[model samples]
Target: MTHSTRSSHPRRRTTPRHPVSPRGLRTLRATWERQAAEAGGPGGFHHLHGPHTHGWLLADAVPELLEPIVHADDDPLEPTFFAHLDAPVAEALLARFAPAHLVHRSNGSPTLGNQLRATVAHPGEITLHGFVLGPGRCDERLVSEGALVRFEADLLVTEHHAPGCECELLWAYAVDELGLDDAEHAPHRIHRIHRAEAPDETWWRLLWA
Candidate 1:
């Protein structure tokens, strides 16, 4: 999952933190090592942002690429849903959000770089992608989920959720990211139908077979 390099980890908190086992930590570290190797080998450590950025550092990128879709109120590709994005960016976002429904959230915020961030994930991928569309350079990275949790803990994050099949939300986030372009690239027809909900008690009475 790719997200913004900026710090905005406090945006969502519904998912609570669970203890990390010693074995889990070791496994996570191994995953991180592999990620670092993919990024030209871990040449020591570097500080990107925050205090913990000094270990096995990975670059970052804008978070909106995937976060806004799942977090959208309804249709992930709805123009209004991504109004915050520029014309070009919005168009790209729509292309990615195809095969979506209009079920939207009462509240949605586009504050990836400025004040918030979005976590983009995909199934079968060990690294999480992150980016920041705010000021400074465009930072992006593919980092290990285990290492990210360890780094997050160092930042004193009271709650943490490691990315894996065990966590439904994280799993969905990953799958959604991976499948963003699935609807557009499929071999068969992809249908998206819209239906209005019953307005009142008598609304259902008008239904007919």
Candidate 2:
């Protein structure tokens, strides 16, 4: 048998190019990782939405802005980047992803709620299901199991049953504690406010807020 000659140079590992966040996506990733590790099980990534989905969407839609949340070994249903979401966190995320005047798509009606107004009116009560890029359809994909959201009075989100967390609490906090309507940067102050006044620290610490 003839011996084959090998090259001296080592092959370089190829990593796919992704989006980037100005604040450094690694901070978000680190926060989730720490939260998960501290929780001692799967962390906050246990739910359908929450921090895992937040990271996933950022990575998927704008990978160049932040690192990807899901890995090759990640579970399709339960991902691996968990964190408790409170009023400030939810509001910040909503501001980042679901802006104020985004076109609403439910039942194909032009008359619907705008994201900002509804969120402002009712904090923490809105939890978006399905991908944000596609048309809102009446199918299993857009409307997942128990992820129903109902609106009242045109601007307030009355009821919300999301997959992983209780968003209504956050909304209540926004209305009661944060006074989101008056403060333009209320979302930015959620963490501090939550740390100070949340009634159930155990629940907030144990699972997604």
Per-model CA lDDT versus the true structure? 0.23, 0.29
Off by over 4 Å in 1: 1-10, 22-25, 34-182, 187-209
Query: Can you give the TM-score per candidate against the true fold?
Result: 0.20, 0.22
Score candidate 1 by lDDT: 0.23
What lDDT score is found at residue 8 in candidate 1?
32
lDDT of 2 by residue, 1-209 (tens): 01121122222233344434556335434543443344334342243442222222332222222233222112223322322222333333333342222333433211112333343454444322222211111110111111112222122212243354344455455446433233222121111113334333311111111
lDDT score, candidate 2, position 159: 27
Query: What are the runs in model 2 whose C-alpha is more than 4 Å off?
Result: 1-90, 93-101, 109-113, 124-126, 134-209
lDDT (Cα, 0-100) at 191 in candidate 2: 18
TM-score of 1: 0.20
Which run of 10 residues does model 2 get worst, by summed lDDT? 137-146
Shift in Å, residue 186, candidate 2:
31
The candidate scoring highest on lDDT is 2
